[model samples]
Target: MKLLYTTLLVVVYIIPAINAAQCLSGQYPPKPERLLPTYVVNLDAPPVERWQDLASKYKVELKDLIAYLKTFLVEISPELQYLVDLVDTKLPAMADTLPAPYGDEMKGISQASGLPLGEVVLYNIFYEVSSLCTSIVGQDEKGNIFHGRNLDFGGLMGWDKINHTWALTEKLRPLMVQINYTKNGQVLFKTTTFLGYIGSLTGVKPGVFSVTINERNIVKGGYIGLIEWMYNINRNQSFITFAIRDMLTNSESYNQTVKYLAEVPLVAPCFYIVAGTKPGEGAIITRSRKGSDDVKLLGRDDLWFLAQTNYDNWKKQPFFDDRLTPCIKCMQEKGKNQVTFESLYNVLSSRPMFNKETVYTSIMEPATGRIEAYWQLCLDEEAPCRPW
Candidate 1:
């Protein structure tokens, strides 16, 4: 542990300086030779067995992911072990009680992966508390809306846990999956997420809208409150990420989707950015537990874009969410005229926006149902400080 702390200090301080000029220099790792395959989850299958197909196909990768998640459980166990351990056992039952298919899907993932249900449950909930992301929505000259984001997640301490060979983010790169949820014969919605998790932090309802979740800044008991809510599971309770998925599956129009997202009850606070297919269909919904704390939309006449980076849109100079200002500045420079898939991808992949913690970048267009999900890495050319 002492050695680990020392290494972390070196990573946080010394390495950033070594790579100061290169960090977020619009340099990205050579795109992976192949993207992870989309898992087609059939709703017709019993929820308990829905993930069996994925398990059969990606058994080895799933085992590797389980091993990776255990390191985090072990690392953070000192302070939260009692709670984590207790809830670990109750996860399967919690799944049974929650109205969503999460519990059953997790059970299916565990059963198919040949792993403990408790660990799988913990893995599903882990990122909800820790992920830091950037989401941007814009309208182009043609009136098509574009939505893009980078999903960044990793506990700084446990990042180098993979035999110290790769960061947890790197290990997660290959595990990225774009899940297409199929009902009877057609695709309902799609989420760019990890393989085992059933929730959607980044998803799109084709030709309708796209939505992304950025962890909200908490003044007080946000993380613990969410865990407590999960511990005492109720059918009445719904997680925001689960709510995002539900919205994608059910909501038909952009306006209807906005209303549902802004009004849904959540166990925690978060920022939901939605982009529609029309000219002025974009919004950033800053949410409290019960409903929206604030809803900022586009089309303040020439207001062509909105960028969110884990802070309430109303705050000035968010203390920890440093990415917000830079994000806005970059988008403004790109301008509304350049708001295409490729240009937005450029904005998201640039430095500051594209930092070491980013695991994957997602670009979506609801107009034509175009979704581009890619695993990300910062090469030494981009970030010498990249611990992975």
Candidate 2:
């Protein structure tokens, strides 16, 4: 009788454990229509010649895409047009806030892609200008910082979900570029970006840090607050991803990266996940559009593993609430093992939290200068969905 009773208790505990573990192996999503294109560009050369080279390589695609975006602007044309006009009047002052290299790069993009300077400016702030995404940061068993996300947005122009559909292979793939910037006297940085944009929406500079950004849900303040946000456009502050780009240029450690991200003034409310090369260094930072003083960080001290699925840490916004518990359980179990690059990949692959809208996925081991990424949402079709 005693033996049977003990057996029953063990079974009860083990069954739930098995069920939780199974969530990591959830159903594989169907393949995306096309794989995202990846390429490299060197901006170390003279700005005119360099951008002109890019223009020459992808001129046709860039031209068409710009037209597509302009069409989307038609839907919210009045508001966006007013904002663009505001930016145009303040262009010089706004450009001054960016590091000098960005100005050169933007000019190169504009010149090379045949995009107007004003259009180039709008493209640089795409994330803030566009709708949504989700970012997560966690440390592997080896303690390397890794961040993953699903970048969701209304399809470019009016292709209607075209970003995820394979049908966009020819048109969209050509515009996907992985820029490698290595000026003679500057830090080397690599970014996975669309052609003709000069910001780091997602990228890494090995030995510095791997970083990504997401937007905060606008606050539910009174009408007075909304009016104030509209009137208080500070073009002089660094836009979100551009701020991450600036940090990669100067910061050398995880702490320094966090500090820079915390102190920088930004044009919109944003979240940043920065994983450092050192153990216990990665962090998720939440800040109000109001700026630095509103900065709050959730780091290893708070939780050894953290994931941001388009929700602020404070309010625990519930977009993917169902996936959270299972993901947290899976990551914790994996952390107990010899966490390899594959381990990090598994966490993102896990269906409970791996968003269907994921357009790109990246895994980084900054300490060893190793990084791997798969884009265009095709990782599902691969037999063994491990890092490439």
Which candidate number maximizes TM-score? Answer: 1
Count clashes in each candidate, considering only residues at least 3 apart in sequence or on different chains.
2, 2
**Alpha carbon lDDT of each predicted model:** 0.73, 0.56
Q: TM-score for each prediction? A: 0.87, 0.73
lDDT of 2: 0.56
In lDDT terms, how accurate is model 1?
A: 0.73
Per-residue CA lDDT of model 2 for 308-380, tens digit only, reads 6555555654432334455666777766452455665666666534433345555666665555555544333
CA shift of 362, model 1, Å: 0.8
Clashes by residue pair, model 1: 24-351, 95-103
Superposition error at 319 for model 2 (Å): 5.0
Q: After superposition, how far is residue 303 of candidate 2 from its true place, in Å?
A: 2.4
After the best TM-score superposition of candidate 1, give how far the Cα of residue 310 lies from its true spot, in angstroms.
1.3
Residue pairs in collision within model 2 = 33-166, 34-166
